[model samples]
Target: MKNKEPWYATTADGVPLVAAVPLVDAQEEEEEIPVLVVPPVTTSEVVAFAAAAETTDHPQPSAPTLEESFQQQLSLKEVPTSTTRREQKREFKREWRTMKRQAKQEWRQMKRDAKLEARALKREFRSEKRALGRNLSDVKQDLKQEKQMMKDDAKQIKWDAKSKIQEKKRELHHMKRCMRKNMLAGTFCCH
Candidate 1:
């Protein structure tokens, strides 16, 4: 049987560990070369590597405290107490009902006032119309009386003018008869 070569290393805990491989081909059989294996990584070495990778100019963030974390969780939940929530709702409802009642009362009062005002205006307008009608009728009656008086006066003046004209005509005829009689008695006078 050929001698078997160890291809891997083991730790104390039986964990299989590997480091950087030596710069030699394992499958080649032309020449044998000494392999230089690196040691397995330890926890302190890992921590030193991490610290070396980060620069000191920048600050690292600190972990939150227990109390701060608890407060943050509580804030995220933001649950209100049931009793306080109920009281707030009750107050809101009471205010809403009060406002609604006040608005309704104001509306009713406004309607009543408007109706009263309209009725009063209607009565005033009716009274004015009736007064205007009475004044117009009185003026018409006065105008009719004046017109009748003018007609009667005109008729009386016409009758008086006709009687005067008839009296003048009768006097003229009497004078003419007297002249003729004087001429027949031989006492003729030129008129």
Candidate 2:
């Protein structure tokens, strides 16, 4: 037998043990879900990312603790900032125009095309797995749930952010209602 170990036995970070500190800590602490930025593409980069994230997870106790530092004596209104009103208005106009341009149907069409390309790649991989005599159904189901939760989370985030950025009281109130409902829904099923 060779001295080299099998690939399946190695960790993403090349460790023999599969360290699952983040998941374990999340279970123990009930922390609000942290933003999972896309991991870098390379295997080594992903390994490094996971390892670093695991280390960071230990230091985080809960979201309330993190929010406490920013919560005390906070003004509800955000002033136009260091920039004067006129300068802020000009910047907001520029940003709004850019945002409107990006919201156009042509941009949406391009995004749709990109999504179709990604779906095609996923289909190809599924077929390749079938040819390899591997059952990918269980893995696919887990991926489906994760994707749905991510989509809902992203939509909620976008709407919440829009309400904040526009400073719309009615929209903010409505968004809060929706968020409360979502929290209740998750409370029943989310682990």
Candidate 3:
């Protein structure tokens, strides 16, 4: 992947070859986006389609309720009057659009409030994420260290067996201490 490659969904030509990064302003706010993914078709898709056709069956259900049957009969009423119908349709669409905009605005406001609340919480509990990150990082460091210690040369092992055992035991004890400290930190941070 290129160093400057986008980090989120963009051109869905096989997951964009990578995702796209959110664009940012000077104050570090992320830009929002809407995406639609449509993949291209090929022969494997056709074979899967053929297999599905061979395996699938459509089952018909029996009976309908009295109200359902009546609605089915009655819904095909006299055709709506043209100009009045068109006017009503236009009004309905306008109302629908107005409602949609209002809904989106409300949703955006709510999200902003939620983000504020999260930031406030984070500020109140400063060092939480850093503490968690440190705990996991320490565990990783300890594992790396133990792995390094365990990589023995044959000549060194023959000459220094007791020293190696003592060193290995010390390493194991250090690892156990790291594990315990990490567990405590994790529980405290979570709570």
Best by lDDT: 1
CA deviation > 4 Å runs, candidate 2: 1-135, 168-191
Clashing residue pairs found in predicted model 1:
none
Tens digit of per-residue lDDT, candidate 3, span 135-184? 99999999998777776555567659878888999988887877787797
Global lDDT of each model? 0.81, 0.68, 0.72
TM-score of 2: 0.18
lDDT of candidate 1 over 1-191, digit per residue (tens): 23235456778997768754546665664455456677788899899988987855677689999999999999989976547877989988999999999999999999999999999999999999999999999999989999999898888888888788788878787778778878788776454
What is the clash count for each candidate, in the order shown? 0, 0, 7
| Residue-level lDDT tens digits of model 2 in 1-191 | 22222223355887544322232234444444343233225688789988998878465565566466566435444443646888879989999998898789678999999999999999999899787554467678889999999999999999999878787777667778777877878653221
Best by TM-score: 1
**Over 4 Å off, model 3:** 1-83, 127-191
lDDT of 2 at 187: 50
Q: Can you give the TM-score per candidate against the true fold?
A: 0.47, 0.18, 0.24
Residue 183 displacement (Å), model 3: 77
Give the CA lDDT, 0 to 100, for residue 157 in model 3: 78
Give the local distance difference test score of model 3. 0.72
